[model samples]
Target: MILAEELTKILSSDQVTQNLTILQQHSQDESFHEPHLPDVVVFPKSSNDVSRILSFANEHRIPVVPFGAGSGLEGHAIPVQGGITLDFALMNRILEIYPSDFCVKVQPGVTRLQLNKELKKYGLFFSVDPGADATLGGMAATNASGTTAVRYGIMRDQVRDLEVVLADGRTIHTGGQAVKSSSGYHLNGLFTGSEGTLGVFTELTLKVYGIPECVMAARAAFPTVKQALNTATSILTAGIPIAKMELVDSRSILQMNRFQETDYPVMPTLFLEFHGNDNGLEQETAFTRLIAEEQACVDFIYESDSKERKKLWKARHHLSYAFRHGSPGKHIEGTDVCVPLSCLADSIEHARKKMEEADIDGAVIGHIGDGNYHTLLVIDPDDPNDRKKAHEINKAIVEFALQHGGTCTGEHGVGLGKIRYQRTEHGNALDVMMDLKRLLDPNHILNPGKLFPMSSPSTLNIN
Candidate 1:
């Protein structure tokens, strides 16, 4: 057990919360998993403080779970082993804005929406947007990507640099302000999605993009998911540079309509966004319509007005909540899978059939342009049978994706949910990962019991 005197010496009594209720709140994230409360919750206000706390924890061989806002779908921020919960909420601040370089430096606790709001003053915005108002640090740690990832790319792509605190109180800058680099080791890439198992990120320097001159958003409907997916593929094959293309099935549409109090056709639909000047937008829309027609699309409607487009996308953004709203008292379990573009349609169809065979009710949604999709499974948390069926469905979906040359997860990093498939998916690569984990975190004090299963007692030699 960690000594209270040592902790108090590191951080103020006010900064360290010993309350069981507060610790419980910090234990679990938005995942459906049971909570494991940390022994103590430490709110560090600076990089040095974080480093010192980690140094002490490393010396004591105590698990240190770096936490952001705890909005992750996966159990990324949960303190599974129940040690110290390092909350970055107090460190929230925008450190700097390099408008000319198109990058911003910020603390880990700053949310994406908060960063974007500040960036709007300079006509710049960070593009990697997961649906939830997730912290930028949490987003980077998870390597999160959402609808815009089809065009702008993931959090790893947007990150320019990271100020990471290693296990032994060492601070290192992984990347830099330069737009491109052929530097040594590519440590930035290694830590971006490390999910706090490697180190705690104190500050992040992220790449930002200039706001588009003109934007056009559209919704295209089809009688079936096959047609909607096919339309998306056709549009991509036709060389339309769509900024964002998302697939929403009929079930999800009904949920959206009920939750948002707005009516959309209860059919498989594709939400699209085009970013360019007026003429380019017009051409893209025309080309999109032409390609979608080949896939038997029922209708293709475009919204050019900014207000109306925001309203439309807002509804799309609330899809997960809509699923939860539609099924009261049920928890939402979303499966994220990415298949090769050639096999995306088949994969979706296979998953849909499996859900039907199991008599499970869920909705299929996708960042179709990238061949990545999610099936939101709403299940009664109180029912063990329901939970078992959801797991089976998840397993089937993951297996289907792997069979199709796809990853177990698209954007949501391998937290507790996908750990079982690491060996199956990566094969020999898993051995290399184990080596890497040992080399960096020999003590295994950082977010223990996550990302990888516990190593055999004989294999661990922490000294």
Candidate 2:
């Protein structure tokens, strides 16, 4: 019997599949990276199922790639070796809720929107929103952060514990129910962003937050990118405690206007939010308005009503799709680089100039509050020149980020796309990382050809 038949012996027949359509769906993520099909797909209903699947694959030397919602932007979900793809859809369940402790335990497949909808009853919500309704498991894998990261922190901060199934099928819990610990190893931090190369996360205990008593959203348009950046930095310098600070350039605003059918000013803009009690928010917005005005803010619009506030954020979240709608017959090559606040303006300006020099149609958008930004480049996949220009621009941006004290990838994990820069970004630490990977997965049956670039197509030799 083949791998699918063997897996059926371990799992229910309905849980094991080699269907062409399912394989095609599991082949890639939401990225421009080339797709490759998995040989078989298996859905695990419990930790025991995951353990059995890993034990079998490890012994037989078959590659196993853990897959969640496949919403990743960096090709992290592709099963390059064509072995088994472990789909977590069947394992999605919010196992526990401790409202007083501000923690929730969940299976790996639960999506952000699904969890938030359920959390609404207790006036609690998970804060690490990566815009997409991405599975919490996938977000944990990528260490995802979004607009609210400046206030609530990244997925790494939200994780309290992880129940991981090792390559040899040994089950381990990286952490526990306690809020803080001076424990050994800090395994939770290590495994949270391992990108499936270390082990498979079967269960996650994440930190949640109570809904803020008062919230407000504002939009400030600036005459130039520098002015907008200056205003944002000023707010942070002054310690205004803003919940979310997002930057959208003129080109992005134009696209958002056309796609969302809203009349936002066609200029560089900052989407700002404040979360606190009414008295505190009143003071914060007042001080923030003062800073924006001093920096030559062209227009400042406030949305106090909850409905209008939600609508404002909705437009910002759908920006990637808006770019797609604005540019047909083209794919978006999103560049993720983050720099220190002091260098953010220069980095962004450099990215914009590179795009202009290449004559590429794209937009600059980001979570400016925390200095993570994206240069969305629209390129015709069929045109070699377009692809080359996009790659060159991305390289320039990454080089600039690395030259400064910034990361090649801020929120997006180093999958197939960012592996080339791993050496430059992490240096000797990359060697240490590879050593750990080999130590945990001696046979390299975990996700291969990712995070660490392959020396050859058929082997996992990193040196």
Highest-scoring model, TM-score: 2
> Per model, how many backbone clashes are there?
0, 0
Q: Give the TM-score of candidate 1.
A: 0.96
Candidate 2 residue pairs in backbone clash:
none
State the displacement of the C-alpha of residue 409, model 2, in Å, after optimal TM-score superposition: 0.6
lDDT of 1: 0.87
Model 2 TM-score, all chains together: 0.97
For candidate 2, the lDDT comes to: 0.90
Residue-wise lDDT of candidate 1 within 208-326, one digit each (tens)? 99999999999988988878887887777777768899988887888899999987888889999998889988998988888888877887889999999999898788888888777
The whole-model lDDT of each prediction reads 0.87, 0.90
TM-score of each: 0.96, 0.97
Query: 1-463, model 2: which lDDT tens digit per residue?
Result: 3778788899999998888999999999988889999888999999999999999888787888999999899999999888889999998999999999999999999999999999989999999888788899989999999889988999999999999999999999999889999979899999998899889999999999999999999999999988999999899899887889999999899999999999999999999999889988888898999999999998998877899999998888888789888888889888699999888888988999999999998988879988899988999999999999999999999999999999998999898889999999999999999899889988888898899964312332111
Off by over 4 Å in 1: 455-463
